[model samples]
Target chain A: MNGTLEISGLSKSYREPVLDHLDLTIDDGVFALLGPNGAGKTTLVSILTTLVLPDSGYARIGGVDVVTSPREARRLFAATGQETTLDDLLTGRENLVMLGRLLGLGRGATRRADALLEQFDLAPAGRRTVATYSGGMRRRLDLAASLLTQPAVLFLDEPTTGLDPVSRNRVWDDIRALAETGTTVFLTTQTLDEAEALADRIAVLRAGRLVADGTAEELIAAVGGQRLVLLDSERNEVRSIDTDGTAASLAHAMSSLHAHEQGLHVALRSPSLDDAFIALTQTHQEVAA
Target chain B: MTALAPDRPSSAHGVGPWRSSGVFIGRSLRHSLRDGEGMLMAVALPVILLLLFTYVFGGAIIADGYVDFVVPGVILTCAGYGAASVAVSVNRDITLGAMRRFRTLPIVSATVLAGHVVASVLRNLVATMIVILVALAIGFRPSATVLEWFGALGLVAMWILAITALFACIGLVSGSVEAANGYGFILLFLPYLSSAFVPIETMPAWLQPIATHQPMGPLVEAIRALLTGAGEAPALVSLAWSCGIIALSMVLITLALPRSKDR
Candidate 1:
């Protein structure tokens, strides 16, 4: 529970409901809160990060209530915001060391700053001011600053919203590497691909509430099972079949295609989360109606 | 890959409250020094005005000892100019991601504003001295005792602290850095219209009352008295105004700071 988050009946509203009595729990691992533009993804992160207070409900980070004791909860985590929260005028090393000093690290602050700069492969660029840094460098430096004081939980608010594919992959690798070390990462994303690519557990939020919560495969199954398209040597579709997406069912479906043609190729396509999101969102609306 | 590891906060083993304040103050000081243009303008504006008024406009005015009289006023204006940037810096911290990140940490976020104010005050004091030295070289002389000179310096410092805090409040409430800078410009113009350049009596009758009532007027009059060894210092009156501005700005900042962090 040291890196876990629990929320129950958490609600917040500005002009209207942004996050309605939403309840959620995240265990130790990479968890993604996937939602479109206004699904209260930020509101949730803001509340958890103590940027804003929720109207009603409680949220606990690693079992410490964020509302009642934000300072204690602060000690348990670090966050990287969407807007690149860095002092552009300061050198990367200065920024990191300043954060270390602010966090009360004393001389260790400088030592950690140097070590982090080298580790991020930014030792060469650490002497440069952030204003001169490229977008990728800025993000990497921002991440380095956040990790100055390692927290049990790490919150990344849309960690890669506007990065090129290569930079995005680098950040992804860094994130995945962090999760491998047993730090619970809670990230929010508008793109389902990012969620699926990074999160072990994905929760889709719609209009201030959660519509579905499960693994990628479970949400994929919710919309429809996997599709099997048998192709000939020319790569033209020879036969199409639907299966329940289970190991046995996929085996059966593949075997059925095996008897049809000797030179056929079999291609299996997993269900997309885009379809799963639409299906789940429509299901919630239908039930409400 | 484990670069950020074993990196947990050493809060328990490190600095006390005073050292924490030192780091924030040091950051703002660095920013003040790096902003070369602002610092230059703060020193240059007063020096430029002193020369212009002492030579350019001095022949037209019949007032005796104009340089001596105008130097104190110019120093007061110089402090105002130096304090102006505090608002812009404060606004940047609030509207940008810097203060947002700070709030998430274990430190009190209000210290950012305090750092700005203290750093601005120190920067302005230095600018004030440069202006004074420039005035002295250009035939400006005063007849104050050593203690009175100290009194004038202390009063000027208090006035700088007050104005700096006021600008900081402007920055806190401003929606953008440009807006804060604009407000600073408005503050810069206020000292010019006061008894800074010419005596309030020389102004049109209607404008005289407005100039006399402004915050800069009392401090200028008091400082002039202290330096010239002339009549009443009106030190109590200027102190009251400076204290009032400091108190009001502090109240507004205390009230505005928490809400500044909100959406």
Candidate 2:
């Protein structure tokens, strides 16, 4: 249970309940929370980061209760919000230095600012005002600022949503680097590729509730994998392999179809993470309906 | 792309408010100075108003001695312009999510607002000095002693601090920067309705009470007396008004600040 997150009966209501009585136990790793708009992804992240208060429930980060000891809980995590929050009027270097100072680095603030600027590849334009920076540069600067006070956990809300492919890759590398250092990352992203590429555990949220939680391979396998499709032209028969039906059953069904004809065509389509996500959410919708 | 190291310094330690406030205040001052349009509006508008009132309308309003009579009022009016800048800047920060970012940080939450308010006071003082210099250049004269001049500055500084706090509160309550400017107009126009540009005796009986009893009137009168050796400057009433505005502003700002859920 070390570096674990425990949430029990966490709920919030604004006009409508954005998060229901939810419970989860998350361990150290890159855990991606995937959901559609208004699925309470941001609301949940906000509450966990101590930016918003929950009506009821308990969320503990590294053994610190987020509600009762908010200040203490805040010290355990750093959040890079959905939007770029750097001061546009200040230069990139100034923003980092100021944040470093506020984080209690004191004399080390300047050195840390320089290191961050260099690491983020913003060294050349570090002196330029943030207002003049491109969107990608601003995103990088925002990420760099968040690293000023390295916390045990990092929350990135759609960190690379509007970024170009190269910038997105850069962010992906940074996130991987952070996780490699044993920092537990809670990321929310609309990009399925990002989730598949980095998430050790993925949770799908629908209607203010978690519909599925597992490793990518497990979820995809749970929905079944590699459907076998066959066409027997002579008898005009078709057969599909089901995971539950097993290899012997699938072979028997196919062989029965082939007994009546020699012109048989077969194709195996492996299920992807995208299939699992769609299937999980589709089931939630069916149940709700 | 350069490889980013996974190593980082831990940030669980707390930073004292005094150190954080110092950095925040410095940043605010730098921003205020760099804002060219704001600087022009704060410093130039008052100079233009002073020239217009002293040269164009001086003859029609009064035959002579208008310079000494109107100089203090012009200075106070300039301070009003500075208040508008404060309101706009504070409003921009709140709407832009900078305040939210600061709130999530480990530093003291109120330090950002305090920095902006203190910077506004400093800016207003600079603008007030510029207006006074311009007025003197354009034939305005005063007959005050060195000690009286210092006294006038202290009084004006206090008034500027109060007005800045009041406008900061207005900015917080306002929904947008444009709306904040609309709220600021109330303070900007207060000078015209007061005895700033003209004497209260010239106004109609109906407007005299308002023109005499308002905060701006007592402030202008107090500054005028100090600068020109006029008798009985209503210093007590002016001080009370300034203190009241500051107190009320603190309460309003506290209530209007952005909350965690609001962000």
Compared with the true structure, what per-residue lDDT tens digits does model 2 show for residues A68-88? 887777677778888888898
lDDT tens digits, residues B1-263, model 1? Answer: 24336654522222445776788788888887777888888888778888888888876774567898788888888888788888899999878789888888877667777778889989988998898888879887889999999999988998988888988989888889999998877766887787777778889999888888788887888899899875678788888898999999989888778532348
TM-score, per-candidate, Cα-based? 0.90, 0.91
Please report the candidate that would top DockQ against the real structure.
2
Q: Candidate 2 on B102-209: residue-level lDDT in tens? A: 777766767787888888888888888888888888877788889889878988887898888989888888889899887766776899888788888999999999
After aligning candidate 1 to the native by TM-score, how far in Å is the CA of B190 from where it should be? 1.7
TM-score (2 decimals) of chain A in model 1: 0.84
Cα-lDDT of candidate 1? 0.83
CA lDDT of B155 in candidate 2?
82
